[model samples]
Target chain A: MEVLRLQQQLIELTNSLFQEGFLDDQFTQLQMLQDANNPDFIQEVVTLFAEDSERILAELTKTLETEPIDFKRIDAYVHQFKGSSSSIGAQRVKAVCVDFRAYAETENREGCCQALQQIKQEFFLIKSKLEALLQLEQQILAAGGSLPVME
Target chain B: MENVDGDESQPGREETGNLQNLLCGKKILVVDDNRVNRIVAAGALKKYGAHVECADSGKAAIAKLEPPHTFDACFMDIQMPEMDGFEATCNIRKLEEIAKESGKIWHVPILAMTADVIQATYDECVWCKMDGYVSQPIEEEQLYKAVSQVLSRT
Candidate 1:
């Protein structure tokens, strides 16, 4: 019963993520790569994404505050952030990055700052959601239940 | 934990998939400055049975491509710290020229792998003589098509 409940929770959370546009098909591709040979592949990749995103976000914030603001430098950091987010299939965050880049390209300081805050919020939202999903998977495993396949 | 699926005809295949064996026995080099991208790209290639190796930077990739190269193809990231993909590809062309002058026919196909697949990036890749380009967050079909395109040409 415990395993079944966790499995139900897992499926619901996974579906919600996809439905809410927090993730995309790329996330499914990431899941597909995991197998017995790499049971923790998703966990490893998500951890890396979290660490890398935080660093990039920090750099963007600091660069935005500097005088003679280097839009080029901020764009580069945001570009990296965009790549990593999309690599992990973070759809909403990646969408904000697209807007962020356009603002940087045109030297729109106000737009850039607003987009930065939006991107940060989206990143944090997805990060916690991913954490919850991973936690449910862990619980299911502990109860000797295999993860349910997401359609 | 019993092996339930007994469709064990292809013994050498790395993972379970219809796409298995598409890149069997092919050695691929993945060049990227970002660690996650390297792992993700390598994971995708390995799924199709390719022997995937990685270089964290363009300079490292160049060093790996030294005389008597063995990689069947290379997937190079366009942006890096010291040496970008275009510069690396140029340097590689030079090396190939040297090899050609010595009467050794050699040209390991190079493909540009970038997150930004804009027209400008594509134009620059062609300008640098890259064989093909595949955008990042690589799709399996797209990657396979690009890899095979270059592999068949060589």
Candidate 2:
């Protein structure tokens, strides 16, 4: 019964994440990659995403702080961030990165800064939601239950 | 409604099993500057039963391939700091030529792993003698398909 309860919780949380636009089908792809042999697949990828995102965000912040801002370098960093976010299916963060790149390309300092803030806001929101989802998965596993299939 | 015995019925299990069979015991190298990229690529390949080794940069990859040339295949990441994938692939081809001249026939297949899938980007990989290309955010099926395609050629 504990397994069932945890499974239902995972279902609801995942649904909410999708409904809220924090994730997309790519997240489902990531989940599909997990199995008994690689039970930690989603967690590992998410953790990597979290670490990589943080580092990229810090670099972006520093790069934007300098005079005569190097738009090319900023674009490169944003490109990397966009790729990582898209890879992990962080939909909103990736979306903001798209806008961020446009600002970087035009060398618009004000626009770029605003886009960076949006990216941060989206990243943190999705990161916490993903962490919660993973925690629920752990709870399910601890209860001797497998993760319920999404969709 | 569906049985979840953690068996073949699982969504990707059968495909994963097939990939493991195709890649099992194959020695492969993953070269990428990003630790996260390396980990993700290595993890996926390892899950499919490939014996995976990694190099943090193109130069390190070249060092690993010198003389011995033991790796069955390689996944080379583009856009590294010093030597990008194109340069690295070119160097690897040079090494192959030298090995051939020395009466040692060695042709290690290399696949470019890039986030950029532009037509010109792929053409550049082929120009540098890379066997094929795999797009980034590496999916399991795509990785397996690329590996199989490259291996099939040789």
Candidate 3:
């Protein structure tokens, strides 16, 4: 009963990851780095994502607030965020990065902030979706089932 | 939706060949994390009469590939949680030997899809050796072109 419920949840999470693109190669490699020795790999990686995202957001905010907006600095910051998000397959955030980068390129401070806010929203969405996925995985294991199979 | 670009888009269907039967005999694998995305892709390809399978992540996609697999091509999303398109594509490429040994008609093609459609993004696509790519906000005609270009097996 619980197992079946968990299975459904697991599938939902998996689908969200696909829709959002947070399960790409870089994320997978991070997953592969996990084992019984370090079972908290996924959690650790998520924490990193959260922490890193916060830092990037902070920097983006600072740059946007500058009277004479530093577009180059903003571009660099966006570029960094873009790479990290790209590696993890954070589709929504990565998509936002494109806009932010363009705005930075043009030194459109307000546009950069707008893109930042959007990325922030997407970040939370992906985070929640991933938490749901992780919870389902734990439940599946608790139910004595193998992880949900994709495909 | 036959390329419904609000009457401002280009041709809906390609005139090169009968795309309906183009992939009739081809087997395709859709590797994406989202079920909706996978279903959308499969549903679209099914209209063209091709057999379809789906993987929720890169990890899942790799596990499904075997000598017995008869995929003419794969439509892989760039980002997935378990394994990414790049890794999955590499894995599929490595399976070429086994695919040949199994007497399959042709080697598989891998196409990358993403919402990340920028100039740099395209360069990355080429870097990944993606046979083809389709941008996000995916339309029917764009999808058809991608599938047709990759599935030119018939």
Candidate 4:
């Protein structure tokens, strides 16, 4: 009964993420790629994404604070951020990055700063959500129940 | 599951080309400065039964191609730090030219694996003499198609 409840929660949470546009089809592709031989593939990729995003975010913060801010450098960092976020299907974060890149291209400091904050917000939001989801997955597995497949 | 060659079902072989078979026994090199990107690409290629090797940077990739290069194909990221894909491809081409001078004629096809599929990006890829490109996030069908296309040429 507990396993069933966990499964239901997992499914519902996953549906909400997609419905709210927190994730995209790319996440589904990642899930599909995970198999018996590589059961932790998604977990590994998510961990990597989170770590990489933190590094890029820190870089963006530092670079933005420099004198005579180099928009080119800002653009490059955002581009890297965008790639990693999109790779993990962090749709909201990736969306902010698209706007962030445009602001950087135009050398708009105010616009870039605002976008940076926006990106950071989205990143943290998704990070917590993903962490919750992964934790729930672990709980289900530990309870001897298989993960619920997302429809 | 062990059908690495993906040639087990010969009946539907012609009609439906097995996706896994496309990369069977092929060796692929994936170069990306980003750790996550490299892991993602390598994982996907391994699923398709391709022996995969990785280089964290363009310089590392160049080092791997020292001599008697055995990689069947390479997927290179475009916007890496230090040395980008275009520069790496240029350097690799120079090495190929040197190898050609020594009476070895070989060109290992390089596919630009990038997130930006813009017109300018494609233009630059061509200008760098790249065979083709695959988009980032590494979709399976696209990866297979690009790899098969390049492998067929050589």
- Judged by lDDT, which candidate is best? 1
Model 1 agreement with the true structure over B88-112: per-residue lDDT tens digits: 9889888888888889977788888
Writing each residue's lDDT as its tens digit, candidate 2 over A1-48 gives 888988988899999998887887667767766877788888888898
Model 2 reproduces a share of the real contacts of: 0.22
**Candidate 1 local Cα displacement, residue A7, angstroms:** 0.1
Residue B142 in candidate 3, Cα distance off native in Å? 26
As for lDDT, the candidate ahead, 3 or 4, is 4
Give lDDT per model, in order: 0.83, 0.81, 0.67, 0.82
Ranking by lDDT: 1, 4, 2, 3
Backbone steric clashes in candidate 2, count: 0
For model 4, residues B1-154, the per-residue Cα lDDT tens digits are 0111212312233322555666768888999988878888887777767888999899998887755789888889988989998999989888888889899886888899888677326678778878888888876555656767777654
Badly placed stretches (over 4 Å) of model 4 are B1-17, B119-123
* i-RMS for every candidate: 7.8, 6.7, 13.7, 7.1
Question: What DockQ do the predictions score, one after another?
Answer: 0.30, 0.26, 0.03, 0.31
Best by DockQ: 4
Q: Which portions of model 3 miss their true places by more than 4 Å?
A: A20-38, B1-154
Worst 10 residues of 4 chain A by lDDT: A24-33
- As a TM-score, model 2 comes out at 0.87
Per residue, candidate 3 scores C-alpha lDDT tens digits across B1-154 of 1111233333345632455656666788888765434544565466556788888888777777654566677788886655778877777666766677767644467778674555326567666666887654244566677767766554
